[model samples]
Target: MNYSLFAKVFVAVIVIQSFIILIGGQLNIIRVDRLIQQREYEYDRKDMLVVQDAYNHKLKQIRTNVLSLFFDSTQSESILEKIKRYKGTTKAEDLTLQAEIQQFLQSMAYTDESIRSILFVRNSDEQKFAFVRYFDPSLLPNFESMISLKEDEFVKVYPVDASPTKQVLIFILKVNDPNTVGMKQTVGNLVVSIDTGFLQIEGDPLHADSIIELKNSNGTIRMSGNSFAADISQIDLDARKHDSKDYFVTQVDNTVDDMVFTMLISKKQLKQSLFAMKKNQWMTIVAIVFLNVFIAFYISRALSKRVNTVTRNMRKYTPGEFVNPILIQKQDEFTVLEETYNQLILKLSEFIQKEYVMEIKSKEAELQLLHSQVNPHFLSNMLEILRMQAIKENNLNLSDTIYQLSEIFRWNIRNKETVVTLYEELYYIEYYLKLQQFRFPKLQFRIVLPQNLQNQRIVKFSVQPIVENVFKHAMNKGKETDIHIQVIEAYDSIRVSVKDNGKGMVADDLDLLILKMQKPLADTKDTPSVGLMNVHARLQLIFGEPHGLEVQSQIGEGTKVILHIPKNEVGP
Candidate 1:
C-alpha cells in the first residue's frame, strides 16, 4: 500500500461513507423508538382518562344509591320508621324493622355488595354517642367511626380494616329531613358498606407489560391490580421523567378524593406492529456495516500506525503514568493532531479527578446528613419498644407501643401545622405514658380533664415533650414515675398541669428554669434541652403575654410544669 495523497483521499472517502452509514442506522433506530414511546405514552394517558371517567361515574352511582334510599317513598317509610323506633343504641331490631330492612336489602338495589347495617343517627344530645335503628352489626365492626366521615368516597383501603381481601369500600351520606329537595337539615346519617372493589373499569385486564394503581396524595398506593411496588423504595414515586424508550407512564388525578390513578405501559407492547419492520431494518444495517467495514478495513491500513500511536499514548492516562509531549520530526497533520490531543487529554484528566473526588465527598456528606436526621432519643424509645415486643408475648402492649410511636411520628414529621386538637395532644400523651410505663416497669400516670373539654385547640407536639421532661428530670432508675395530667377551667381560660412524683428542684433552680423558658428562643447552634425550649417558645408564639411554661418544685416531692393558653385564641 502506497502512503500518498491519492491513497489518503481514497481512505478518507471510505471512512466518511462508513461513518454516514453507521449514523444513519443509529438515527433510524432512535426515531422508531421515539415514535413507539410517544404512542405508548398517549395510550397510557388515554386509558387513564377512560378509567378516571369510569371512577367518576362509579362515585356518582354510589352517591345516587345513597340518595335513592332516602328519596324513594317506600325506602323513606322504613328509614323514618327506624328513627321513630330505635331511638338510642337499639342493638336488637323489631320484626317490622327487620322485615322492612331485609326486604329493602334483598332487593339488591344499591351499588354496594350487600347491606352490612343500616344506621340511622337521630339528632339528640345523647344520640351523638349512640346510633338509632342499627341493624346487622356483625359485618360492620365498630361502625361508629363512620359518623365522623367528613366526605363521601369509595374507601377501598381503610387502615384499620384487616379483611383478607381488605376491599371493603364504604359510602356514608348525611341524611336530611323533608325527604324533598333543597333540605340541608341533618336528621340522620346513612352507612352503606360495599363489598366489591369498585369494579367500574371494564374491558381486558392489564397484561404483563402494564400496571394500574390508585395512589393517594402522599404517593402511597392505596390499591393496585397486581403485586408491584409492594416495597415502595424500589420505585421512584417523585421522578420527573415519566416516559422512557422502553416504557411509558401517565397519571390522572381524581380531585374528588385527592387520589391519582396511574397507568404504565411497555414500549414493546405498544409497537407490536412496528416491531417486525425493526428486525428488517437492523438486518439491513448489519449487512451495510459488514460491507462498509470490509472496504474500510483494506483502505485504512496505511493510517492505522499513526492512529495507534495516538491511542496508545492516551491509554497511559490511568495510574498517572504519562510522559512529556511527543517530538515528531515529520511536518504533517499527525504531529499537530498528537500535540493537540495531548493538551486536551491533560485538561480532561484534571477535570475528571476534581469532579470524581468532589462528587464522592458530596455524596458522603449527604448520607451523613441523612443519618443525623434520625433523632437519637426517638430511636432509643423505638428500640425500647422493640425490646418490649421481644420479651413479652402479649401483642396488645406491643400494638399500643407501635401505635403511640406512629402517632408521635405522624404528628411530628408529617404534620407541619402550627395548631392541633387538644384531644389529639392528650391521646399522644396517653400513648407516651403507656410506653414509658412498660420501660420503667412502675411508672403510673393518670389524666383528669373537665367534662367535655378535650376539643380545645393548642400547638402541635405541645404536651408530649413536657411529659417526657417529667420522666427525664423527676424519675429515678429503680423507682416508679407517678405523673398526673390535669386540665381544669380557670378564670375565663384553661390550665394544664403536668405533675410528677420524683426528686424535685429547689426554688432558685426552678426560678432560673422558668426564666429561661419565658424568654423567646432564638435559632442558635448550641441550645440545651431543645424539646422544652421549642415547646415553650411555640406556646408563647401562639398565645401572647405571660402565657407559657411555669415550673414549681420542692426538695423531695416532685416537679410540676404548668401550661396556660387562652380558650379564645386556639388555632390551626
Candidate 2:
C-alpha cells in the first residue's frame, strides 16, 4: 500500500493500543468474573447456614413434642398400661383399650400439622396400636421390623412410602419404664410419621433460580425447593466441588441430623451481574481508546505537514536560482532538519555562483581566441608598408600615426596573458589617445602614473576600454574634449581614474550604466555598457569584489570612471 507517513504512524499506534486494550480487557473480565464467583459463593454459604439452623430448630421442636407425649404427658401412663395389658384383656376390654390408645395418638397428631401419623407398639405381647392421619396403613412396615430396632438407639429416621406418588419421613423412638431398683425396662416403641414438606425451607430461596436440597447421609434427597432435581452424580459430592462453569455448588453439613444442605447457584446469573458491574469500566476504556486515536492522528498529521513543506521546497529548487528556506513553527527534530537543509541550499547557491562566473570567463576567452585566429603578421606588414609610404611622401604625422596603430595592434594580439604591468597599459593608452587626436584635432589628454605603481600588474585591456568609452559617448562637438588619466595608490589596492571634459551623462543614465556594470558579464553582454561591464567583471573575477569599476558623472560637467585593482599582483 502507498501509505503516507501520517497514515502509517496513525495506524501503527492504533494497532498497538488496540492490542493492549484487548489484552487488558480480557484480563479484567477474568478478574471480575472470579470476584463475582467468590462473592456469590460466600452469600450462598451464609444462606445455607441459615437454612441449616432453621432445620435443626424444627427437628428439635418435633423431637420435644414426641418425647413429651410418650413419657411426660397426663395420658402417658394410661397409654403405656393399656398397651401392656391389651394382650390379656377380654374382647370388649381390648376394644376399649385400643380406642383409648387411638384417641391419645389422635391428640398428638392434631398438635402438629407436619405430623402425618403416630403409632404405639407394645413389646411384651407384640401388640400394636396405630393412628393414621395422612398415610396408607398398608404401606407401614411389619411390627416385627419395628420392634427389631436396638434399645440403645433412642431415635431413628426413615423414608417411608405414604402412597404410590408420595413419601414421608418417620421418626421411631423407644419407650422405657422404671423398676424398683431404678433400672429401666423397655415398654414399647413410638413411631411418628412426619410430612416430607417439613424438610423444605420456610421462606423464599436466596436466589430465585437456585436449587436447594436437603439430602440424607446416603446422598438421597429428602426435600427439595425446586421441583427439577439436579443430578447428584455429575458433581463430586465428597469433595464438595463448587468450581463448575454451569453451576456453583455449596454444601453445608447439618450436624443435628447428619444431613447435608446443598445450594446450586447458576453461573449464568453471576455473569449477568458481572456485566452490569463492569458497564462503566467498558465505557471508560472505549473513551480512552478514542482519545488515543485522536492524539495519534493529530501528531501524525503535524509531522506530515512539516515534512511536506520541506519536500515541496526541495522540489522547487533549480540550479542558479533562489529557493526560499522552509519555515517551521515548532522546535523539534524537524527544526534541525530545516536548518541543515537551509545551510545546504546556501552552500549550493555559492557553488552555482562560482560556476556561473567561470562559465562567463570561459566564453570571453573563446571570443578572444576566435579573434586571435586572424594572421597578425599580415596586418602588421600592411600597416608598416603604409607607414613607410607615408614617410617617403613626406607625411610625418601620418607615418607616426600608422606606427602607433601598428604597435597597439601588435601589443593587443601578441600576448595571451590576462594581466599586464601598469606601465605597459598606460603606454598603450597614450598611443591610442595620440591616434584619436589625429582624428579630432581639438582633443586633449593627460597620463599621470605614480612611480611606485608603474610595475603593478592588472587585468589586460582594463584601462583602454574606459578611455575609449569617453570618445564613444562623452565627446562635445565644436569644443575641446579633454581626457585625464591618473593612477592613485590606496589602502591595499590601486585606482586608475579616467576623466573626460566632454558632455557628461545624466543621473538616470549613469545609474543605469552602473547597474548594468554590476551584473554578471554574460548577462550584460548585449547591453550598451558591455565594455565597462566586461572590465568590471574581469577585475572582480580575478581580484575578488571591492576591486571593480566605479563611475561618477554629471550632465554638462564631466564623467570619471575608476578602475579598482589590488595592490598585490594576482594571476587570473
Candidate 3:
C-alpha cells in the first residue's frame, strides 16, 4: 500500500497490542464467568441450606407441640384412657371424650397458625374423630385413604391435598398401650395436618427467575417459593450450558423428612451480566490500543523527520558545488551518519578542486607551448632557400647543415597531431642534437632504438623536452658530453632513457629539481625546470600515474632521465 513509516509503525503496534489484549480479555472473561458461577452456586447452596434448616426446625417444633399435647400430665392420662376405653359405644363418656378431644384440637389449631386440622381414630371400631379447619369435604376420601399405616412404623409424614386449593403436610403417629409389653397393643392413631404453606421460603429469591422447591425423594413437589410451570428435573441444570436454556440447581436434603430442597437459578441473568462485563473490557482494550498507536506514531514521525532532513540535504548536493552540513539536535545514530556524510562531502570537494584546476592548467600550458612555435610555412621556405644557396655556392657542409635544420623545422611544424611514432620523434631529436652539436662541438650523442619499438606512439613533444633539458643543464663547458638515448619495452609500458656524461647535479640539487617538477605548473613557471615539470604534468594528466618522469643522478655519475609511456599503436 506504500504506507509511510508512521502508518506502518502505528498499525503494527496497534495490531500486535490489540491481538494480545483481545486474547487476554477473552481469558479474563472466561475466568470471571467461572468465578461468578462459583459464587452463584455457593450463594444458592446457602439459600437452600437456610430453607432446609427452617423447614426442619418447623417440623421439629410441630412434632414437639403435638407430642406435648398428648404427653402433658393432665391430657396424657385422660387422652390415653379415653382412646383405650373407646369401642364404638355411644356412651356419655365416649361422647364427652370426643368433645374434649375436638376442643383440644381446636385450641392447638388456634395456637399454631401452620396447623390445618387434626384427626383422632379409634382402632377398636375404625371410628374417626376429626377437627377440620378450612377443610374441603371433597378431599376427605383422599385424606382417609392415606391414614392407614404399616404395623412396624411408629410415625409417618406425607404431603396430601387437604382441599382443591389447599395442600397440607400430614404427620401420622400410632397410639399404643404403654401398660402392655412385648408386642405393644394398638389403641388409636393421631394425625396432625400442617399447612404446606409453612414449608415455603420466607424471603425473596436471589434472582428474579430463581425458584426454591421442596420435594420428596420420589420427586413430587410438596411446596415451592415461586410458581414455575416446567418441571425442574426436565430442564438442563448443567452450569456449562450457560449459553443455552439452563439453570443453576442447588439441592439440600432435609434431616427431619425424606425431602429434597432445590434452588433453580436461570442462566439468562448470568449471561446478561457477562455480556456487560465483556463490553467494558473491550472498551478498555480499544482505549489502550489507541494510546499505544498514538505513541508509535509520534516516535515514527520523529524518526522519519530526521531521515528526511538528511535526504533533503543530500539531494541539494552536486559535484564541484558546496553543500551545507546537516544539523541534528539529538546525538544518536543519525548524528553519526550526518557527520560522516559531511566529511565525505568535504573530501569530494577537495578532490574536485585539485583535479579541475590541474586540467585547466594542463590545457593552458599546451596552448602556450603551441603558440610559442614559429610559423611552419615561412620557416620551412626560408630553411630550404638557405640550403639551396649553400648548394649553389658549392658549400656542401653548410648546405647539409641547412638541410638538417629544414628537416627539424618541417617535422615540428608540419605535424598537427597530438601523438607521433617513436621513430618520427627520434628523427626530430637527432636533428635538434645535430644543431646543438653546431653550438657545442664537444656535444656528442648516440640514439639506440629497438626495431619493434619504432612504431610505439607517444605525445608529439614528449622526448624533445627531456633532451632539451639534458642539453641545457647537463652539458660540460669543455669536456666531451656523450649523450646516449635508448628505448626499452616492458610488459605493459615503454621507457625511454636519456643518459649523459656531463656535469651531473649533486644529491641536494637533484632533490630540489625533482621537487620543483612535481609542484603545480603555476609555481614552477618562473623556474628554469619549467620544461621538465611541464613534461611530467602532461604525462600524468594524459595517461595518469605511473606514466611520468623518473630521474637518477649523482655528483660524479651522469644523470639518467627515464620517460615512462604506455604502449599503444601509432595514431593514423
Candidate 4:
C-alpha cells in the first residue's frame, strides 16, 4: 500500500480503537464501583465480627471477676449471712460496702463510666454505694426487689432497666461473702450495674461500622456488646433458616450459661472487600487506557505537524501579512475534516453566546436552587467561635457538640449530592451531637445505629435536623432530660428515630405542624418551626412522598420522630 494511504488507514484504526477503549474504560469504571461496594460490605462484616469477639471477651471478663469475688475461698454462705444480718439502719454499713465495691471495681479495671452502681441489700437494713468515681447515693436500691425469682439456685442475672438512664448492661450476683460463707449460708444479693458508657467505642475510628450483642438461648437479646439496639432475637429467627456457620447465633460463654456462641460478621466488610477488588481492577484499566491515549496522541501529533506545514505554505503562497485561503489539490477525508472543524467551531461559538443569554434569563426560575449557596467558610468560623465559648465556660460537652455540628455542615457542603454510606452518616451524627450536647449537657442522648449499614448509601443530613429539633424544643428546657436515637437498617429500607423525654406536643399541634411541614412555602402562610420544616423539606426533596417526617408526641411524656427512607436509591 502507498505510505500516505497506510498512514490514513493507521489513523482510522487508531480512532476506532480509541472509541472501543472509551467504552471499555467506562465498563471497567462501572465494574469497579460494584466491586468497591462489595469490599465495603466485607470490611464492615469483618469489623463487626472483630467487635463482637472483643465485646464478648470483655463481658466474659466482667462475669469472671464478679463470679470469682463471690466464689473466693474467703467468701462463704455464713459470712454473707452475717453481713446481711449485721446491717444497720445507719449509712455506716453502706459506706463499708461502698468502699469494698469501689476497691473491687478499680482492681478489676472497671472505670467509673463502666460501673455505675454497686449495691448490697440485706434482710434487715438496705445499704449500697453508687459510684462512677463519684457518688450517687440515690441509685442504691433494695437487693430483694431487683432479684430474679425464676430460679431457686444461686444464679447470676443481667438485667436491663425498664428505663435505663443510659444504655448499659447491669449484672447482679447473689453469692456468699466471707462473713456468710463462714456461717455456711448465702444471704444478700450483690447488684452491680456495668454502665455501658465505657463499652462505647469512643475514640475508635471504626466504631460506626462495628456491632456487638449478647443473646440468650431463647434468642432474646439479654444485653448488647456494643451500643447498637438488640437484634439478636431477629438474628436467631433468621439463622434457623440457614446453616449454622452462615447464621447469626450469640457468642457462647459455656462457663457462665453455656449459650450457643456465634457471630455473623457485618456484611459491610464483604462489600468493602469487593469494592477494593474492583477498585484495583478499574484503576489498572484506567492506567492502561491513559497510557494508550498518550502514545496515540504523540504519534498523531507528529503526523499532523507535517501535514500542517504543507497546508501552511500553500495558504501563504501569495501572502505578505494576510495569507491566501487554502486551495486543496485533492478531495479526501482530511479536506472534509478541515471544512467540518471550521464550521463546527463557528456554530459552537454561536451556541455558547446564546446559552449564556438564556442562562441569565432563567435565573428567576431557579430561586429555590439558590438555597445551596451557603458559604462554608463563614459557617466554619462561626462554629469555631461557638466551640471556643463552650470550652471557656467549662462546657467541654457543648464544645464537642459544636465541633460535631461543624463537621456535619462541613460534610454537607463538601460532599453535596453524593450518596453517602450509612456509616458516614453516623459519623456525622456523632459529631453533631457533640455540639448539641454542649448546649444541653443535662440531656441524655444515645444512638443505636446498625452495624451492617456500610453497604447502604443515604442522602446526607438525613437524620440530623430531627435530632436538632429534639434538643431545640424538648431537651434544652428540662432537667434530667433523655433522648434515644436509633437507626434501624432493614433489607428494603432504613428507619431513623429521634425519641426524647420532654414535654411533648398535643394532637392539634401535630395537625398544624405536619401540614405546614409538608406544604410548599407558597401554600403555607408562615414557615413551620425552623428545624422541623427544613428537615421535612429536605427529606421530601431527596426521598419524595414515600418518606417524610412522622412525629408521635404526648403532652406530658415526650416526642418520637421516625424517618423512613428506602435503602436502594442508586444502582451499583
In candidate 1, what residue range of length 10 has the lowest lDDT sum? 126-135
List model 1 lDDT by residue over 1-572, tens digit each.
66999889998997787678767866876797677555756766777777677656655665665555554464535444455464344355665564555555445333234333344345543142122222333235555654544434323322223243343344555766655575655665655544324433343435555556665532343334444425322555346245475556677888777667766655565566466655576467668779899879875874687788788877775634445665565767677887787787677766676566446544653565466447744765675677577558667666666666666665555554557667777877787788787777888889987656777777766787788777677777777778999987788667888998889988898877767776555332322124766667667656865676777789788988888877853444
lDDT by residue (tens digit), candidate 4, 490-538:
6667887888888789999988888777664323222222366655654
Candidate with maximal TM-score: 2
TM-score of each: 0.34, 0.45, 0.42, 0.31
- Model 2 lDDT tens row, 1-572: 69999999999997798778767877888887778767877877877887777666666766676455445455546456666767646699888877777887888789878777887777777666778887733254553564456756766666555653455766667777643254368887787777655544354455645666666632244333333335432444445464576677888987766777788766776677667656656577778879999999999999998889889888888878899877657788889999998999999998888888687667867775676658676788899999999999999999999999999889867876778899888999899999999999999999999888888988888888788888788898899999999999988889999999878999999889888877766354432224888788778888898889899998999999999888875333
lDDT of 3 by residue, 334-361 (tens): 8888788878888999789878877766
C-alpha lDDT of candidate 3 relative to the true structure: 0.73
**What is the TM-score (0 to 1) of candidate 4?**
0.31
Q: Identify the candidate with maximal lDDT.
A: 2
TM-score of 2: 0.45
The better candidate by TM-score, 2 or 3, is 2
Q: All models: lDDT?
A: 0.61, 0.75, 0.73, 0.57
Task: TM-score for candidate 3, please give it.
Answer: 0.42
Candidate 2 vs candidate 3, lDDT winner: 2
Ranking by TM-score: 2, 3, 1, 4
